[model samples]
Structure formats: structure tokens, C-alpha cells
Target chain A: MITIKKPGLLSTIQDLGRYGYQKYGVVVSGVMDSFSFRIANLLVGNEENTPAIEMTIVGPSIQFHQDSLIAICGGDLSPSIDGQTISMWRPIFVKKDSTLQFGESINGARAYLAVAGGIVVPYVMGSASTYVRGKLGGLLGRALQSGDQVEIGNLTELSKKVMDHLHTNGPAKWFVPFYKPINPIIRMLKGHEFDLFTDASKNLLINETFTITKEADRMGYRLSGPKLMQKEQKDMLSAAVSLGTIQITPDGSPIILLADRQTTGGYPKIAQVISVDLPLLAQMKPMDQVRFQMVTLEEAQHLFRKNETYLTDIKRAIKLKYR
Target chain B: MDLQFYPLGDQAVILEFGNIINPTIHKQIQVVSNYIEENPPDWMIEFTTAFTTITVFYNPEVLFYKEVCQELSHLLKNIKWDEPNEYRMIEIPVCYGGDFGPDLIEVAKTNGLTTDEVIDIHAKGEYIVYMIGFAPGFPYLGGMSEKIATPRKATPRLKIPARSVGIAGTQTGVYPIETPGGWQLIGKTPLELFLPNQEVPSLLRAGDRVHFTPISLDQYMEMEQTRS
Candidate 1:
């Protein structure tokens, strides 16, 4: 069991996302940075889609009520256990009643914490992700409150082995590296309305830097940089929208839809941030500047396949180590 | 007709049938959607429809973009658009005017018509569900009478009760959930528009036709009582 001592700005349980419900207009609310969420699970010997605590810009202070093995991934929220700084991408053993706290974030905007077993929350539509707007999933269909007591699910064989190893004073230097883009540039594929924008606007989108505005949230990142006007003003029919779709509003500002975005939108989409680049965009904070680069559909597919292959290899290596 | 397939992202592609909103365009969208729903591709994750476009989301890890587009194009060519309708025309019980509809009087005054005339014109129109969006099970309906048409409220209310049947511009829809909206409410429906726990959460679907049957407030209360 885990008890939240002080719930930070925004903290909720999330997995990959709720699937098979967008046709019914249910938002697939999940961790903002799924790449980090998956890695955090992997570090603790859990499945990639295991539910974890997704902390926002600020992180909550949690106390473990039972002995557990845990991993923290994504944004560097400067986590510490009993006043000692903890590593970000490694599993550590926490004794019963030990408290974990966080200071100011040093690198990114969101962090994920994974226990050996996933968070035990009743699933709504086959996902544990909390969709606050609809009050769909997670603990009572809302963010973790300060006094919330989260139960841990039963551990898998791998998790049980990992926990037993950690209990035996295992190697202290075990860690895995997460994907971190060297440049703050998100790659994208052209949208259906890509050609509708003026040539200058298209050029500016790829060359100029856009600042993430204060209106940024789990729903979307309203970017301020170029005024990308379409050649003609036409009312678009509302269509199914997904994560990382860069929609241009009537005022011409670009908004990148994120995890908690509406299932469908009527705005003209200019570009779609590639799946491989979503992690980079997910970590961006307000006032951070980012550039966009156009990539072919094949290139985007290739990058995603490479990432998946890496993930598969890591899982195999970890299994071999346990054996 | 030339079907233009465009990339929504790495995960989804949209097949656009036409550029405008018309019954024929909507029918085309429905035909494609129905075909895919009946014979779903292994790679297809989910598919949704709009006024004239059907966007198909897929698992990119399972199939490449080129293969998906090609498969869709081939399947579209073989689709027989002429099919007997399977969906039913559901009649919704609505209590128009008075306390159930706050904007009823204002809309009638703006359109230069009596409140009863406005209600009659709205209730008589044959409406079709074009899509579900904005909120869970909130239908974007088409085919409202132009005589009852009115602009949206200048300032949207923070809370519009669920099951409220409203109009905005040329379109009519039902608010499935309590949400902030700008639509001009003319009536309230007793039937639930959205049920979250069921296999099919939404009470309506794309291509379903709906008719509004006027009922007294007593009838509405009795129906609400039976529901609980």
C-alpha cells in the first residue's frame, strides 16, 4: 500500500490509455509521456501498460506502507528517499514506512512512478487511466488526493523475482536509459490541410521556433510563433483527432492535441507530430521553444519500429539476467 | 467519385468522400463505415465518421502506411453503396417550452414566431445523426427546419443539463452530458442519450434517424421515474 502525504499540482494513475472507446467519444486519457511510462514499468519488471502514478510539473510526496520495489522515470523531478537523492531510471528497494518526496523538476515537465506490481484500480473500458473530465477510471475517477491510499496489484513472476533479488542486497548500479532527443525538434507528417496554409506559413512552421504558451495542459499545447492562415476560410466537419495532431485555430495559432484531447475536433489540422517524437513534445514545459521538422510516413514508421525493437531487446536482456 | 485518402498521423488515415455536408455525402460516409465495421481489418484499431469523411485509426506497428492506404482504396472500390438500412428510426419524447426549455421564448421572439410555432417547426423536422463528439454520446445532428434556426447564445452557460435538445445555427443536437454549451435549448428529452456501462454506450449512432415526439411534463417525470 502507498499513502500520498501531499498531492502535488496534478497527479493521477495512467497506463498506455483507454482504447476501443473513442468511437463512443470517450477521451483516451493516459500518461502524457507514454515512452517514460513504459520505461518506468520495464525497470520494475512490469508490463509496459502497467498502471503508474503520473506526476505533473510538481510531484507528490508519498509514503510506502509496505516493502516494495519501485522505479521513477521521465522528467527529473529531483526525487529523494529519506533526504537522499534517488536515481531516475533504476529500481530501488523501499522499506515499509519509508517516505519518498520530490523537489523542483530539473529537466522535464512530467514524471512516472512504477511499482513492481501495477496500481490496483478498477478498470473502466479496459484501462486504468484517469479521465477526469468524464470521471471514467483510476482511483474514484479523479486525481490522487493527499490522503489517498492506493493498493498495489498482485505481482507477476518477473516482478516477484525482481523484488526478491532487491531484498537480497542486489547490484546497486542497475539502470536503463530512456529515449532523449538531442535537439528540441519534433518531427511530423503533413496533415490533410497542410497545403491549405500559405507557403510562407509552411516554411515558418519548419524553420521558426514556437513557444509553448501558458494555456498548455494535458488537453493541448497552444503554441505561439507563426500566424498560419489558410488560403481559404472553410468550416471543416468535426473528425476523429488523436494525440500529437497540430490543429490551427481561426486565430491562426497552432495547438498540439495531447493525451486528454477531445476525441474529435473541427479545426483544420496542419501537421501531425510523429509517434516517435511524441515523447519530446510531452516533456516540453510552458515557455520552452521547439522547432518542427517534416518527415515522410515511411521515416516515421522506421523510427517507431526501431524504438519498439530496442524495447523488445531490453525486455529479453532483463529476462536473461533474472534467469 | 475520386476518394482522397490523407494521413491524419502515423496512426490514422482519413478517406474523404466530398467537400460539403449533404445527405449523399453522409450516406457515402456511412456505407464505408458500415462495410469496415462488418468486415474489420486486423490492423484497424477504430474508425469514426464526420460529415463527409471517415477517419480510420490503426496500429502502425502491425501494418505499414502504404499497405493500409492501398487496402482501403481496394476495399472502397468493391463496396456496394446501395444497401437496405438496418438502423431503426427512434422516437424521442421531448417536453418543449416552459421550464424545460429556457431559450424557447427567446428563440421564438428572435425568429419572429410564436412559441408554439417554433416548437411545431422543430418537432416536425426529420433529423439524422451525423456523428458523436464534443462530449460522450453528444450527437452532431443534421436536418433541422430553417424556420426554427437561430444563432447560438452570445455567452454560453457553464452548465447545460444532459438530455437537453438544442439548436445552434442550422444544426440540432442533444447534450448527452452536463457541459458548458452555447446552443439554444428549446426542449428536454426524457430518454438517456448516453449510457457509459453498456457495450454500446451511446443511445444513437451515425446514420440513425430520429424523430421528436412532444410530451407533457408529467409524461417526462413518469419516464424519468421508470428509468431510475
Candidate 2:
């Protein structure tokens, strides 16, 4: 068990998200960066959908009450143990009564911490993710606060072996894959209402750069960029919207839906960020500028599959090393 | 009935029946939704039904896009609407006017009718649940009396109580949770529209027929007590 000493910013336990509930208008709240979240889980021998703590810009200060193995992944949040700086993207053995602290983010916006065993939280509608608005799932359907005691589930054989080997403190030999984009260009596909926008609006989408505004949160990122006006203000019925959907509000600005977005919306969507580039978008902080690049549906699907294969290969290599 | 489908993204497809909101469109949506629910593909993760459209979400790793589209097309062609779908005629107890409905008098004044007359018209009209969205179990209802139709408030309230029956322009809906909304409140219901613990959280589905039966404050308290 680990107790939260300071719940720095937004810290919540999340898995892949609740499935089979969109018809009931339930939000699928999960980790912002699934790529990093999965890697952290893999490093600790946890399942893909194992619950982990997702920290935002600022990370929480935690005190471990029991010796355990853990992995920290995603944005470089400069984590330290008892004032000693620690490395990331690899498994580390934490002794009982050890304290973990984090400072300002060095690169990205979100960080995921995975223990040897997943966090033991009650599942609501098939997920452990906390949907704050609905008050369902996770640890009482809310973010972690100071004094919260989180229990860990039973660990796997691999996790137990790793923990036993690093009884005091040490890192594993298994390496972690890094995904860093050369340019801050997000690839997107034309949405259903793509043709409804004016030609100038369409051109502006690809030509200009958009800045993520302060209004951004788990729900969506309200961008301050080119005002994309539609040809006509047609009354559109509410329809299903997914994560990465770039919706143009009545004010003409774009809002990119994220992990906790509502199931349905009535806004006109111009583009949808490709699934492969969503992790990069997730790492972007407020005031970060991003350019959009048009990609075909085929290209998007190809990229998604390629990324998945990359992760699968990494998982296989890690298991081979442990064996 | 004809069905139109297009890709929403690489992961989901939006199947639309038509652009209008009517009983025929609702029936078509219901038929397709029921068929898919009864025989869902292995790759399909979930689907959301809205007014005149249903978006089908799937896992790309398990099934190819072309194959999914082909299978959906074949299913659409084979769907038979002759079998009658279950229609739930739910009677919702509402407390209109007074404190339960702050805007009831204003809506009546705007429509040039008395409060009792507005209540009578609203109660007599036949309504159907078009979709459940905006909030969990918050039904977007159709078929409200046009006479009492009013535009939404310019400024939305920060906290509208749950189960508040409201009207905004041509649409009438109930707030299943406390949320900021611009709808003009006409009455309040004691029933729980959305409960997370239930197997099916939402009380009303897309095709369910609904009727409002006016009740007093004392009756509302009695029903609330019985449920608690």
C-alpha cells in the first residue's frame, strides 16, 4: 500500500477506459497517453488494462508503506526518491517507507506510474477509470487526495521475481522504447462535415499553427487558432464523437475532444486526429503550438497498426529478457 | 427503409437513416440498433444511437475496415422490421408549476395561455425518446406541443437540478444529472433516470414512448420515499 502525501495536480487511477457504455452516454475516461501507460505496465509485468496513477503537469508525492516494484513512464517529470533523482521508463525496486517526490515537468504534460500489481479499485461499468463528472469508477470516482491509501493487487510471477532480485534498490536490464516526433505535426483525417467548411477555412487548417489554450483539460483542448467558419450554419442533430475529434464550435474556434469527452455532440467536426498521433497530442501542454497535416484514412489505419506492432514487439522482447 | 453509412474515423462508422426526426426514422434506427445488439460482431466494441443515426465503434486489430463494412452492408440488407420491437410506454409523474417548475408561468405567459392550459397541452401530447445523450440517461424527447415552445434562456444556469423537465425551442428533455443548461424548466420528476449500478443504467431507450402525468408535491414526496 502507498499513501499520497501530496496530490500535486490532477492524479487519478485509470485503465484503458470503460467500454460498452457509450450508448448510455457514459464517458470513456482513461490515461491521456496510452503508449506510455502500456509501457509502464509492461515493465512491471502488469496486464494492458491494469490500473495506474496518471499524473498531470505536476506529480504527486507518494510514500510507500511496503516494499514493491514499480515503473514510471511518459513525460519527464523529474521524479526523485528521498531527494535522490531517479530514472524513468524502467522498473525500480522501492523499499518500504521510501518517499517519492516529483518536480516540474521536463518535457511532456502527463506521466503514468505503474506498480508491480495494478491499483485495487472498484470497477464501474467494466472500467477502473475515474469519470469525475459521472462520479463513477476509480477510487470513489475521483482524483487522489492527500491521505488517500491505495492498495495494490497481487503481483505476477515475473513481478515477484523482479522485486526479489532488487530488494534494496536497482533497475532492470530490460529497455523501454521511446516515441519522439521530429516535428510537432499532428496527422488528421477529414471528418464527416469536412466538406461543409469554406475553402479558406480548410486551407487555414493545414497552413496555420494552433495553440492549446488554458481551457484545456481531460475533456478537450480548446485551441486558439484560425477561425474556421462554415459555409452555412446548418442545424445538425447530435451524433457520436470520439477522442481526437476536432469540433468547430459556434464561435469558429476548434476544440479537440480528448479522453473524457462526452459520447455525443452537435458541433461541426472538421477533422479527427489519427490514432497514431494521439499520444503526441496528449503530451502537449497549454500554449504549445501544433500544426495539422492531412492524412488519408488508409494511411491513418496503417500507422495505427504499425504502432501497435511496435508495442507488441517491445512487449515480447521484455518477456524474453525476463525468461 | 434505406440506410446510409460513412466512416466517422478510422475506428468507427456512422450509419444514418435520414436527416429528419420522425416515427419512421426512429423505427429504422430501432430496427438496425436491435439487430446489431442481438448479433454484434466480434470486432465491434460498442455503438451509440442518436436521432436518425447510429455510430458503430470497432477494434481495428481484430477486423479489417473493408470486411467490417461488407458485413454491416450484408446485415443491413437482411434486417427485417416486420417483427415488432418492444415499445415501453412509461408514465412519468411530474409536479408542474409552483416551486417544482419556476419557468412554467413564464412559458405559459409567452405562449398566451394559462399555466393549467400549458400543463394540459404538454400532458396530452404523445412523445418519443429520440436519443439519450448530453448527460447519462438524459433523454432528448420529441413531439412537444409547438404552442408552448420557447427559446432557451440567453444565459444558462450553472446548476440545474436533476430530473428537471425542460424545453428549449422545439426540443424537450430531462436532466439526469446536475449540469449547466439553458433549457426552460416546466416541471420536475421524482424518478431516477440514470442509475450507474443497474445492468442498463438508462431508464429510457431511443424508441420508448413517454407520457407525463401531473402530480402534487405530496405525491412526489411519497414516490421519492418509496424508492429510497
lDDT of 2 by residue, A1-323 (tens): 99999998999999999889888878888988999999899888888789999999899999999887888998889999999888898888888999999997898889999998889998888889998888888899889999999999999987786677666345665568587663489999999999999999999998999999999999999999889999998889898999899999998999999999999999998999988788899999899999999999888888888888988987787677666
Stretches of candidate 1 exceeding 4 Å from the true structure: A181-183
lDDT of 1 by residue, B8-88 (tens): 889888888888888888888888888999998888988888888888888777888888999898888778878765666
* Model 2 fnat value: 0.60
Model 2 docking grade: medium
True contacts kept of each: 0.63, 0.60
Q: For model 1, what is the error of residue A227's alpha carbon versus the real structure, in angstroms, after optimal superposition?
A: 1.4
Worst 10 residues of 1 chain B by lDDT: B81-90
Tell me model 2's lDDT, rounded to 2 decimals: 0.88
Name every residue pair that clashes in candidate 2.
none
Q: Pick the candidate with the highest DockQ.
A: 2
Go through the candidates in order and give each one's C-alpha lDDT.
Answer: 0.88, 0.88
